[model samples]
Structure formats: structure tokens, C-alpha cells
Target: MAPFTPFFSEGLYQNMRRVCSESEESIHYCSFPQVEGERNERIEQSVARMMTIIDLARNIRERHNKPLKSPLREMIVVHPDVNFLDDIAGKLKEYVLEELNVRSLIPCNDALKYASLRAEPEFSVLGKRLGKSMGVVAKEVKAMSQIDILEFEKAGEVTIASHCLKLSDIKVVREFKCPDGLTDKEVDAAGDGDVLVILDLRLDESLYEAGVAREVVNRIQKLRKKTGLEPTDAVEVYFESLDEDKSISQQVMNSQELYIRDAIGSPLLSSTLMPPHAVILGEESFHDISKLSFTIYLARPALVFKSDAILLLYGGNTKSVHGLETYLLSRDHSNLKSEFQLGDGKITVDAIEGFPARNVVLGEHVFLTVGDSVLRTKGL
Candidate 1:
């Protein structure tokens, strides 16, 4: 963005002085005309010429090579009948930068269409490289109108408020409070033109991707008739962490599992590459460990597919390993105990309770067992 320059700056003043001098010369020439009728005609002609010169000068200044110097930038010329000037300006401002990168500015409207026709092949090639088909590219251009609506919402106000219509298959799991005199039923009603505001609240991973909050807004709109007379208004949906205890990675893992189950006919745990581990207990398993030492066990044999085999398990503290000797002695897994001691390894555990596993990818046949329970296995 360029710094603002005053209208009466040196360069502008010089241009204005030139324009005034040209106008004065024209007026003087007109005054000296010989015939009375000719003088009047000369005066009229001079005024018209002066006006044209001024208009040309103004156009040059407006479209000058200099950078933008004011927050109140360019004036858009549109048909006089267009009623939504503010709405259009607001939407445009949302997407267009104050100082656009040279390559970012593309012709719109008539100019865009003309350019597209002339560069059709090149456009097609570029679109294909970007993973979009020519038809899709054209469709996107046509969809600009709908996109503008979203832009308007984002730019016009910091908080979005709108009534939403519920989809038939969707359901509301919670009641969101609103100040627009809307009831639960009203918010849940199924209808068109229902307004709901989307607050810029940080959401849990699951809710964020699933658009649960947006669904709530739609439900509210649907339930309007049942609640009472519906009011046309917008509500802000603020971000609230739904699962604040869990880390982002843990939420992502859960979401991945859910997606797999819903779309691929198998849960993430059910996949052959990484099956869930089974836990088994023996009669003497509880008594073998020292109070201060704990055994780390794996159910399946370790298979190193990659250079490293890392398993991240969360939820434990120093106290967790304190009672291990007694617990192991009770369990009578002496062989397991011997193997754990021979590994000469480190015990890694978190001090707090939260989602602990992160970036854990297992290789083939690597089965991790804890306390006779298979913690995880390669290939479900």
C-alpha cells in the first residue's frame, strides 16, 4: 500500500495550473472575436473545449502510474440504476488488496471475456496444470456472483449474522444463544432466507471440519415457525474450543478415523495396515514389577519398515512407573520382564492428561503390546 498524498501536492498543483492557463487562454480568444454572433459562438466553443481539456487531465491523473495514495481509493463507474453500490464495494474490498501484485490484477467483465477468448488454449493448459478442467474454470468465473455474497459478509462486518435454513438430514446437538429474540425451534426451523451469523470462534477440529456450528444455524432457521414470529437478523458465531483438552493432532486422528468409517466402509482402526491391539492378562501378571519401575511391553513383534519405529502414547506420570515392580511380580510375566530390561531403553510419558499420541506411523508387523495387551499392530 502506498502512503497517502494530498490532492494539493506539488505535482497535482502543477497539472492544475496548466489546465487553468489553457482555460484562460480560450476565454481570452473568445472575447476578441470580431462579429457579435461570432463572438457568442466562439465563447460557447471555447467553454466546450476547456471542459474537454479539464476532463482529459482529470482522467490522466486518476489513472496515473503513481501508486495509490489514499484509503478512499478509486471510484468505480457503474450504471446509475445499480442499487447495491455499498454492497459491491464492500465485497470487492474484501478480495482485492489495496496494492495488488502486478500479476494478480486480471481484467473483469468485458475485458475478461475478450482475453479468455483470445488466450483460450493457454488458459486451458494452465487450468489443467492447476488440476482444474476448462469447464470447471469457466464455471468458477460464472460463480463469481455467489462468491461476492460471501465476500460481502466477510467484509461488511467483523461478526456475521444471518438466518440459515436447515438441511433435511441434519440435526442440532446443542442450543446456541442469540440476542435476536430467536428461540430454539426458530433457529432449527427448515426454511429459506433464514439468517444466522457465524462467529469467528476457534472450534475443535471435529466441529471445524464437520461444520457443526453452521448446521446449528441452519437448524435454528428451520425451527422459527414453531418457536414464534421469526425475526430477520444475523447472529455472530464465536469460536469456542469444543475439545480444548485434546491437542490438534489428537483431534485430527479422531477425525481421520471418523472419515474413514463414514466414507470408505471401514474405520481407521479396522484397516489392515494398522489394527487395534488386544489386551490380555494372566493370573500372575499383577505382582512382578518393582514399585519404582514399570515394564514397557509390545504385543506384536516389532517390524521396522522405515528407519525409525516411534510410538507416542500419552497420559501418565512418574507415579505410573512407581508401582510397576509389584504389578509385574503379581502378573508373573518374568520372560516379558527380562526382555524389557535387556532393551536398555528410555521410558517416555507425559506428566499431564491430554491427547498424547502424535505423528505415529507404524510399519508392517510391528505390534506394540502394553501389560499383555497389544497396544497397536501393523496391518489391521
Candidate 2:
């Protein structure tokens, strides 16, 4: 990163220095980074296979008009041995499940239910040896059944149409059987050369509503980007929907509150009310999920004065007070941009119940209890 920092951005280099607390201004002064351990070939191969599954699954979802926010029922994998998919699932299941938003992965050695393997001659390989007879052998291989293919896979050879065929002389291809109601018109199939992946396109009510929740998360994530919020800058999120979308939005908030909160990095401020300073998205931003539409609002938390003494009160009561800092700037500083601080206790908060709350704040997070109401600047 240091080598390319100068080419990328000077601000990035400055940020790296500030964040890493590097005394040296230039990273050219630091030692080059290096790998620390021996590479595990098995794990590397597994990860590659995992990536292939995710890529294929995503493509399947997109092609079938299935939105990424909505998760599907399952991923159907067809391989000669179930262990092929099971082995990959053992380590990388979470990556596939989360990335594809699928509920489960089902590995099958039996492809008869939804698919079957079709054997074909490796034309160039078998051509030289079989000569003119290759045409007849290719036809016979195409007509072979699932049982024949399974047996041939084990023995690596079998006599087909009274002609001897070896594993090296043929190629195996898995063809979809097309479940009921689904036509064989479109393949709806993807592969990574070794295994076949078919996504279950069947969607239920629960999954659709869950997708609505994810859509809400997606919107807030967009808002965070639109507002230029830092990754670690936790902003309170709010949402409001029209008369028709109100129930849907509330359902999303009620059911998927945890999911939305974790995704947005903030507790939902309110699902019913939109704040005065709330920035609302127009029709352009609403990528409606199942005819449901909603607007998300974002407000970066504000700490009135210094956040040090949130327990401070101006209600003429004696209480515990710390090094509370307040700024009294010039009358020209109405915009609160560039000012000189003159603390005369001008700002006051009379009604706020204090409680401890440790939050992830700033680039390098520090755990501290800043009162909740104090953070919203409710009284101010």
C-alpha cells in the first residue's frame, strides 16, 4: 500500500499516517510488508471452489429475476460424489450462504431428481484411435443413462453399443431434468467445471418480507455513502413510508430490526417519525421491493458542547460536574464555522436522564459511556 500510496492519493497517505500513528511522514521509510506463513494448498483450493460457487450462484440469481436482497430457498449441487460439495461446504458454507443469501446448500450424488449426466466422446482424443467409428460411438455415448454413467465413473470404462469406451475417450456433462412447472427452455444452470450449481427459484412470503428488510438496509447503506459518513461514524437511522407502505416498513423494522441495526451500524431512531433535519430520498432512490416503498433518513449523532459531562444540569441543582467545556463564539459565527471559543455557560440542558453506553466511535474505537439522550442532543 505504501508503494502505491503516492500514486493513489496524498490524503490517503496522510490518513494512513494519522491512523497508524506513524511518526515518519513517508511510508518509504518503513519496511516492506511480507507474508508470514507457509501456504496451505488444500485451504487455497477450497477457497477458490467457494469463490466459484458464489460467482455462479450470483449469476443464477440475477438471471432468474431474483433480486440479491431476497434470499432463495437452497442451492442444488450435482456432483458424482456428495463429498465433493460437502467438503467445500464444511469450510466455506458461510461465505456461500451469506453472499448468495440462500438458506441452505444441498449436495447430491443422485442427479436423477433434477438432472442427469450425459456422456459424450472426447472427439479429438477418441478420433485418432476410432477413426470413422468415432461418429457411431459419440451417438451411443449421448444415449447412455444415469446408471450407466455412474457405473462408468467407477470402473473408468464400459462397453457401449458393443464398442469399448475408456474414461479418457469420453467427456461427462450434467444436464438438468427441469423440475415441474419450470421449463427446460432456459438452462438456469452454472458450473465451475467440477460441479453443477442450480439455485431454487421458489420464494415464499417470509423470504419476500425478509428481502424488504434487506432493501431497507441497502437504502441506509446508500444514505451513509451519500452523506459521506466514515466507516466508523455511527449515525442514527430513521425511516418513513407512505400510507400503503407503512405496514410493510413497520414489519421490516419489527422483524429485522437486529439485521438492519447491525448492517447500518446504528440503532434505529424511529420507524414512524421523520426528523426535521432528516434528508429524504426522492422517487429516484426507491427501488421498491415487492411493491413496497419507503424513505430512509440519517442524522449523525451530535454531542452538545463537550460529551464529557452529560450529567450536567442547569435546573439550579447541585450535582457532580467534570471538566465540562462549552464554546461561546462571535455573533458572526451563526453558521458555527471557524470560531473562537469563549465559554460563558451559554448553552444548557435541563431534562436528560443519564445512562452509560459504550459505542464504537472514530477510526480507532475507544470504549466509553456517553449518555444516550446527550448524544441525540435532545434538549438542545
Candidate 3:
């Protein structure tokens, strides 16, 4: 499958490029400390820096194949601290009216905090009231002071853009087994050729950042090749906490570990293992699976794989097939009939009427008593 291409807006991309091309002197001069103490010096330095950044931005736009057509609606001057608010304001007014072609230079204490606040409906309403009190247009002033504007520009749109990499085109099969003194060779054989062996490395959430995930993928690929296997069929192992004493339950723990390992190892999958794929949903991650499922479907995957028990179904989609036995195995037989609604179609029950749901093991096919009759269904 082709690697996922990230999407970015043209305006955001151009703004970022301009910020990156700004000079170090200009950045340092406009930074909060240099402009804080002396009012006249701060204004002079800020205006000079703004002019330099704007000029570089224009040059980049003219040279690039794609250029920004629309001028910026506003320029927001962000200060690191509010101690020099008055000085910052004066500098902003001069720059907005003189240097940059923007209509205003709205001074914000923290740009990022402002952006986040503006995102809230309550803040939006309060902003209107505050704008009215100050005799300024509320919608015209948007905040983003907390973020280092220069750094944001340097990183480009990729930094803030959604980091979702749709892997619907990749195909994979999952094999489950309890660790039962199985040798590495036997496990490798079960993989049926080259396979990614994901070891559940139980790590704290803080350690699973993008950089760490990339590192893990690279390390796993090396391990796979060391065993004399192709890179695509490389074995990827992750450590996940299987013990119930840990916060995560066994099923949830297994699912999350598998998902993370699979995503990291996706780029290295062989053709045989590649299929349309979907992201694994961790517990307490997203609210609804239906939306996630829709996103996966839009990527054009034929089937969706999820370890969660709850399935969200929407109208005008392909009818889903469920095995009577499979459902019973994952859940207790008693809980099964109560957990799901039966359609008009005939279902085979595989357990006795009062059979406790927890005792039902996976892969059992039996008749279950529901209402006045017995129905048969497949188990997990």
C-alpha cells in the first residue's frame, strides 16, 4: 500500500514557510525580553523584525509554485509575559498600521491560550461582550499567544495538522494464544512465514509519543531482519501488561498493544499480510465507534477489525454477519442475549437457558434458550 499523504491548507502552509524563513536577528529582536524594558527601542526593533519576516514571506511566495492569493486578515503580536503589555501594545499598533498590510495587530498575552479559549462557545460569547466594552470588533481579534509563532512557522503545517495515517489498504491477520511455554521457533512457525511478533511492552502513556513509536518500529524491523526474514515480513514485538493487577484488563490490554504495534509496523508489511486496515481504538479514546468506522470505510477498506465488544452500526451500510458461537465465547452466555438485540432472522442458541455467561469459553457452538425456543450462534 502507498504511504499516507497528509493534508494541509495552503494558507497555513504559506504562513509557516514565512515564519521559518525569518532571520535569527529578527526573531531574537521581536522576542519578549528584548522588547520589554525600553518602549522606543522595543517598537523600533519589533517593526524592523516584522518587516524582515514579511519580506522573506513575500519572496518565498513569489518563488514557490503555489502562492498565497489572499492577504492575512490580521496579525497577532504575542508576548511571553504580560509585564510589558503596554510596550507590546504600542509596538503592535505601529507595526499593524505601518509595516504589515494587515488591518490590525491584536496584542495577545498568550496566542495558544487565546486560540483554545476562542474554540469554546462560552469564550466566544464573552469575547463579544468584551469587544463591545472596548469598542473593538470581537471576531477580528483571535488569540494564539502561548505557542511560539516562530517555531510554529518553522515546523510548518505538519505540526498541528491531524496526524492520522489511514492504513485501510493494509491487510493483516491476528492470531491469539496464551503464553504457554511456547518456544520462539514454534511461535515463528505459527506466524506462517515472516510475521510481526508484537510483544506487549507495558509502558506508560507518556512514552508512546510519535518519536518513540517510530523508534520502536525501526528497532523491530532490525530484529526481524536479524532472524533472516524479509523487512516486509519482519516481526514486531511490543510489551503490554497482561497481568490483571495492572490497570488494563486482559482483553483491552491485548487489543491496545496489538493496535499500536500494527500501526508502527504498517509501512513494513508484505503484500500477503497487507489489506485494507483500520486504526485500533483504545479504551477511553473516542466516544463513538460509528464515526471511526465510517472514516475507515471511506478509506475504501472492505472489512473493519476492532477488538472492542461494542459495534456501532449505521443505516445504508453493508449488512454485518455475526457468528452465534463467536459472540458467546467473548461474553457470558447469560449476558449475550441481553447485550445484543436479535434481528428477525433465525439465530441458533448454543447454551442452556440459565448458563452463566462468564463460564462460556471461546470457540464453543451451542444452542441457547431465549424466550420459548433455543437458538444457535458462533462463538469468538
Candidate 4:
């Protein structure tokens, strides 16, 4: 029990005892698991830095009361070490964007440039190191400029009163008050001397569209939970926009159509847009997101398959009887068929009728479903 106590949980021990028939009936009898590899300090440091960046973003979000689902326009990150900042930014740029609900991330040189910084000397470190000069050093440190303080933080040492001091020697704090040139629009930021994150709350048309897309996903997830649908089950989705000044309906269809399809496991199966008043399948609901209203419809589980055909070749140089016969032999030559005259012979293409087909809808637009076996749509 003592040997396995560190690695094995009670549940894991019970499971092991039940499953491993050939081994001893107790986890205590088993050997401890071996370590697989050596630790990489650089990678660990990079990850730690990334976590700090994420924490900074989270703090800003909390201060501004911005929900994680509500996507923001941008996040400005300022760090004293350019190389370290770039390493974290380049390595985990996408992760930051996703976790922070931000569209763009801009890395700046000194985050304190936008703020008024004051230096507060650490009495303990300064007193022990400088002794008699501590009082004089504190006065000098308090008078240092933001640039000098930043340099002190970055270099881990500063010259004050002819005495040298390092990071262990000082503490830098960002006050909540905004500095000059920062309007009421900007938010208060929190960070150590090393890193800072500030979020831009303003939203443009594209950002608004992205937010709506997130809402669509959220609503679909809620519907899935309410209806008790399996994760893989595909549901036909229908929606109508309430915003009039901008084309919310069109934006949802054009920008988020593919994402909506894949996320909910339901591709838009309709050949045409469903009218606003059209009766949508399954449990329906209404949502007001970012001051935009949407009437959403989710259809029952459907495994419907769609089919299409193309004329690979039109032989006989437009004048051959065989070409005409080939065109006539093609299946389902209804209103959907296309006819092209090449030379004298004609080529025809049509979608096969009577096959199980999918017709899904998103708002006022419908995706053309034409594939075999498993259905697929255009890339997002």
C-alpha cells in the first residue's frame, strides 16, 4: 500500500485487481512505473511563460466582465524581454487567441509605456545589501523614470546612488489608474514587471459575425443536450436573423455555414434557403445574442445521403449519334440536369433521383449536398 500510494488511485487499484488475472490481486504487489524520459527545462519555461500570458488574458477578461464565449477584437501583450515574448507568442499564438476569445494578438516592447510606473524599492533586499546606503538608494529608486525602472527589471540590476541592485532587490507594480493618452475605452491591466495584457473591447462587423457564429454553436449544443441526441448524430439546422442594419442572416450563412455544419454533425442539406416562416424540423427555440435575435430550428437525427453524376467525356465531335444516345441514357434528367453542346454532339449531367438525399438549411442559405457514401461540404 505504501509503495503504490503515490502513483495509484483507489479506483485504479480496484480496476487493476479486477482486470489483471495473471498478476497479483493487489496494486501493492506491482512494481512502480518507471520514468520515461528526462525533463527539458527550456520547454518547461516556455510553457510556464505561455501560462502566464493566458493568466494575464484571463485577468483582463474578469476585470471587464467579458464572457469567454464573447469574442473580443484584439489583445495587446507587452513584455520586457523581446526574445522570450516572441518565443511564447510564436509557439502558442493560436492557443492564446482561442483561450482569450480574441481575434488578433499584438506583442509590444514595454507594456508599461502606456502606463505611469513608480519604483518601490524592496526594503528587505536593499537593507541587507546596501546597509547604510539603503535610505539613499530608496530615494534614488523612487525618482527613476519608467524607462529606467523597465531596464532595471529586464537587466535584473540597476545602478542607484553608486550601488548596484538586482530583481531580488525591487518590486514593480501596475497601478489601476489609466495614464495619459489612454481613454476610458481602454481597460485596466494586471501583470508583474515581466508581462502585461490589455484587451480591446470594441467590435467591428467581422468580429460581430464571429461572435454570432459562436452563439450558433452554443445554441446547437444546448439543443443537442435538450433532445438527448448522440454526439455523432447529424441534425438539420434552420435559422433566421433579426438584425436589419447589417446582413446577419447572410453573414451566418456565408461565414459560419461550414463550421455550423461540422460542429453539430449536420451539414446544410437543403437545395434552397428555408423561408423565415417555414416550419423547421425538431425542437425550436429563440436566442438574443449580442443584441442580435435568431430563431433556430433543429431537425431530428438524419443519415440521408445525396448523389451526383458528371459527364466524363462527350465523344463523336458533336455530330455522333452515340453522343446523343449517351446523353439520353444519363439518369434523372429532370430540372436539375445541365446540357452543353460541344461541336455537334451534346453532353448532359444530372443528379440521380430516388436516392437518399440530405437537405439541410442554415438561416436563409442552403448548402448544395452532392456526395457519395459519407457526405462532405466545402472547406470552412
Highest lDDT against the true fold, candidate: 2
lDDT tens digits by residue: candidate 4, 76-159:
777666776787568778988888878888887755565557788889767877888888988988888878877777788977
Q: Positional deviation of 77 in candidate 3, in angstroms?
A: 12
lDDT of 3 by residue, 305-370 (tens): 232221222121222214323444455444544433352222344443333222321213222321
RMSD of 1: 28.8
Count backbone overlaps in model 2. 0
lDDT, ranked from best to worst: 2, 4, 3, 1
Q: In model 4, where do residues sit more than 4 Å from their true spots? A: 1-40, 110-113, 124-134, 159-163, 174-182, 186-188, 241-247, 268-284, 301-380
TM-score of each: 0.15, 0.64, 0.17, 0.63
Model 2 lDDT on a 0 to 1 scale: 0.61
Q: Residues 1-380, candidate 2, lDDT per residue (tens digit)?
A: 88966767656666777767635676556567798999988677667777777888888877777878887877877766545567766767777788889898877767567676777788888888788787888898888887888889888899866778887777877766677777533336776435678887777777877787777777777777877777786556666675563766677667776776667665565644432323343212464556776556665443323233233332222232222222211112332222112222132322223422222122112111122432344442
Model 3: what TM-score?
A: 0.17
lDDT of each: 0.28, 0.61, 0.32, 0.60
**Which ten contiguous residues of candidate 2 have the minimum total lDDT?**
362-371
Which regions of candidate 3 are displaced past 4 Å? 1-222, 225-228, 234-261, 264-380
Worst 10 residues of 4 by lDDT: 363-372
Q: lDDT tens digits, residues 1-380, model 1?
A: 23545333445556656757554332223444465433565445434433332243233334432222212222221211122223323444333323221111121122111111111122433344434354554344334343343343334321112212112111111112332564432221111121111121222344443343223223333333333423532111111223434254234435554443343222222112332222211101111111111111112221222212221121233333332322323342345334445544222223323434232222221212221112233233
Q: Compared to the true structure, candidate 2 yields what TM-score?
A: 0.64
